[model samples]
Target: MRVHHLAALVLACCTPAAWALESFVVKDIRVEGIQRTEAGTVFSYLPVKVGDTLDDETAAAAIKALYATGFFKDVRLEADNGVLLVVVEERPAIAQITIVGAKEFEKDKLKEGLKQAGLAESRIFDRSLLEKAEQELKQQYLSRGKYGVKITTTTTPLDRNRVGINFNVDEGRTAKIRRINIVGNENFKEKELLDVMVLRTPGLLTWFTKEDQYSKQKLAADLESLRSFYLNRGYLEFNIESTQVSITADMQDIYITINIVEGNQYTVSDIKLAGDLLLPEEELRKLVKLAPGDVFAREKLTESVKLITDRLGDDGYAFANVNASPHLDPEKREVAFTFFIDPGRRVYVRRINITGNARTRDEVIRREMRQFEGGWYSTSKINQSKLRIDRLNYFTAVNVETPAVPDATDQIDVHVEVKEKATGAVMFGAGYSNMEGLILSGSVAQDNIFGTGKFVNLMVNTGRVNKTYSLSYTDPYFTSDGITGGFDIYKRVLNTSALSSVSTFNTDTTGGGVRLGIPLNENDSIMAGLGLENTKLDLGPNSPQRNIDFVNEFGRSTINIPATLSWRRDGRDSAIWTTSGTTQRVFLEAGLPGGDLTYYKVDYQLKWYFPLTSLFTLMLNGELGYGDGYNGKSLPFFKNFFAGGNTSVRGYNISSLGPRDANNRTLGGNKRVVGSIEILFPMPGMKNDRSVRLSAFLDGGTVFGPGGTRPELEGFRYSTGIAVTWISPMGPLKVSVAQPINNNPGDNLQRFQFQFGQQF
Candidate 1:
């Protein structure tokens, strides 16, 4: 087609402009070349219209404006005999926009967020959109405290007349809190003030939790907390004057300085109450645990306020606010305190709302919530529910919010959001101890079983001298009253050749039991259970003749009904990384009269975890077991206690530390006590995931009979060893090489003993 003909044809199809008539002045002006655009949109751009003169400059300006809309590519103005024409070529509509180099964010989310800045996928490409995207990217980084980030945008025109956009971002080094300096502090030292602040030095753990990274938002919060700290303590005029943050010359470190003006410290001069109370004023005053002539303490005052409000709440005043205001006397540096209370209308919780639980069932959260619909609002119960959810270990984060419903003045709805985490795990572990060589154990378990707060576990133990199989289930909350229940089934075979035995015997055991757990209090519980067992004995070739006579006198193939009562108290900081606490368990088991075994066993175990510092932890474990038989007999030798091995004192052979015979084989005893001390610290140059650890341990113990006629004190043995543990993908693998520190006569000192998947 000819160029002019094609142009004329395009003009004919689009809006037609007014033609110049001979001797006719242009009375009106309009735009032609308008496609996919409203005629009014074109008219709105024209500087001249009806009854106004139409010149070439005016026509050009109108055409330019129309093209600037990013809707056109060609613009021209034609004037014939003072009649002007505005002609333009419309741009093609964007068919698609493809984005690349978006790894930090999802493509769809970035696309949607870009649309808010006039960069929709189907819209025509423009340089302005790229500029806007760069700004948005920088803003996103700034929100996350990444001030050193760099963002670049590249635009490419595609074959289909569409544009491809790429946003290349360089998230530079994180700005960490290098130093926090507090100035103008008289009462407290710099170290003390720094301890009060949450921002801390970047230590070995900084990379894991990222808490040492500096953020203006967090610093602002810390400053506010500091202000409250002084103000609550009767420093009413205390104020933070300025906070300055400066970056180092290398832009790698950040230094923060906070300047504060601490006002006069005051003592309590008088106390008064200004509130309507259902009880006498004296009673209300007593609830506030503050008195005249006492030094000003913000924490105590805050607690006192809460106490008054809680007291009112218990009397059906659910919406009560208590504020303690201190009036300072600057001359005497004394303050007079007044308690102000406001009791709003009593209201009940109409309903509780739950949200953000994308996968978990609603009942899972609801079951843990102590608050109920139609019940009086209890802040304590709500807080307790939050704690319970946190303890579930099924969620990384849980939050509960109460937003008042619109048009419902006295009613509020609660919203709970939970982010789920992986709680089910399968672990296969093996370890070598001086006691049990090449021990293998594993567990396949679910912590949150069937979306309920319960546990189910299956375990297996395969060791040189011990083999065990067990299945267990526990319901943490068997009833609404916080009681728990558990059941276990196990079968084990144990060999005692390494043990210092009074007799040469091995035992094969199969048992199953059920337990009922009752909660005596929040931190204390009691458990009682009955187990049925069948025990078989195999006398070794070198069995003591007298011991064999005692066993034959006692009989084999015994049926035992062992019932035990146990108590445990745990106060460790972390179960795996404890710095300080004690765990003690005591139990007593007595076989029933109907069973073939007629004996009573008492056992006690005590464990202490002491955290010396951020890098060191010490653990001590001790155990004592004593058993006696009644009715003219003794406890079976197969069921006796033995010590020494990886779990026991490390340097000696398995069960080799106790009393031994001339042949170096273990002779079972009626009483035993074992004690071990282990020092655990981070493996040098390793992370805190505790994937690997190095430890040194000392173990000492002995086994003796009721008459104490077996081994002499000079023959008592002990062992010491170094251990290495790896928390690998399969499970925990441990290897220890121990040597006997003290050896008895005929004792075979184990030069090296190793194990995997065990802890001692």
Candidate 2:
């Protein structure tokens, strides 16, 4: 019975083996269910070869590897006649990609930027990367004021395992500041305080600087500046209560409200002093510039304390401490100030340390410093040195500090840091004006020559009837004591017009001069020069017989000596946009014994700028000129003054503002006076940076008799015009179209002039 049972078990096992043999071993591989994938590609993933054994284990492994390619949605593997077969269904390929709701950035630019983040067109798509890209793009727009924007993407399957994606965008309106309110001011009106803030209403130029548009960060900064302004002025109790920013119901505008508590205004009622007295009390008082009755200006008070400390240090008190305190009177709204001083120890300069001059040589900065190592310290010299460094133009900022040694309080280390900026410029320009039509001018100047503290300029002026070429060089420290010297060589040609029987004449002049400039004070200087000139005069037919006769009498070989004295005071807030200040210059030029000509010429110019608001500025300019000759000779034709054109009266032709000949041609004016007033604002759509400026200007002036007659008001031509100025990449481009307001008989109404490259 046991033998029979064993036989039954063996037969049962043998029977299962016989059944498995009925399934044939694979002889060849064939893959099915592949839409866009090749049979060979699927076969490559299989671990079994044609000659190897195939089973469910190996077939399952092959299916998993095929699916891992990320190109298949489903994979299958089977075996027939001992041959292994695999099948794959590829995932769709991206056929297109589209993005919507982007405005601050271009669609193509954003797409290109996203390619680096692993989201690109015409490839397998990943939803995870797409989501990241969408968030990034939205943040970019939000940073630029596009707060309400939406992005949507769509995908569509294409033929042959390919798909297309579309991203639809809806860019909402931009958020703009509607208003800014400042609270807590009693001494100054709200409008006055707002005027002090940099941010203001949007205007024609808001697009450029974007300053008119408000940002939360910028508003916060402006508020902080306001706080500092009041605090520095003795408003010790000034505080900002709250600030609120609200969006309008339409969601298109924003309004900002600020509340402040302005404390009492303080005034100086008494002044007292303590500590060391390096100078007499009277002398110290004179230098303080602060008085008991004056308003308690914190900035001025600090400056006074610094001045006292500096005075003590200059007198061998290197470690001097000066402190100022104000005791307020609540009833009188005034304060009594006291100054305390301490002379700790007399010190010398041990060493001078210089830093931040990466591009400039150390000697360049060292040469301008007044304080030296191993020498007695003088605060006055140190301050003067800082000013000199600033004037170099090579450094955008200069800072000087003196720190005393801990153990040796008598000694100090001087440190100066300089931030560099571009100091060389090459400019070229062309323009058309009534005075000098078809004008071409260019200049190459280096304020800091080759990293040295010097200046060089090459300039050219080419006009329809005149041309000038000049080369000049200046050494600011020619004498090592702040004396400046310059040398210039120039050539000029001028063609004059004739009226009625008076003929036309042409003059060619070449000259060279050496000038020495001496500084009289911080804001004043005196200059004198000697020049040698050679001139040639050519007369046309029908010319004045007397003038032609005079040129022939003098042989046209006139030598001229020109001497000039000038004074200027400039305290403008900014050169491009000035709000308040007065700039004045008076120049006098007289002929001396060295030259063949004898004449005196004088000119005076004054310009004042007033700020009406953050967006509006007013500029007034006035000029007066006079020239007269001695020895019965008229001033050289080249020396005569002429007015009109872009820089003068725009409604008139160039050089046509003064007087006219019988033929209606301009006869150069001899004595001239001109005055102009302009109201400047930003151009529409360009408020940022004030890159484009628009102005309404009124101009009036005239040129009078050749000798002694002064210009008369009755003869002055008056005009009003609209002027546009573009702060272009090259320079300032000015275009003005003017209409004569009070026209005489036969006077033209319209005149157009433009300057391609000019500062003002």
Worst 10 residues of 1 by lDDT: 1-10
> TM-score for each prediction?
0.66, 0.66
User: Candidate 1 overall Cα lDDT vs. reference?
Assistant: 0.69
lDDT (CA) for every model shown? 0.69, 0.70
RMSD of each: 9.1, 11.2
Worst 10 residues of 2 by lDDT: 1-10
| lDDT of residue 38 for candidate 2 | 72
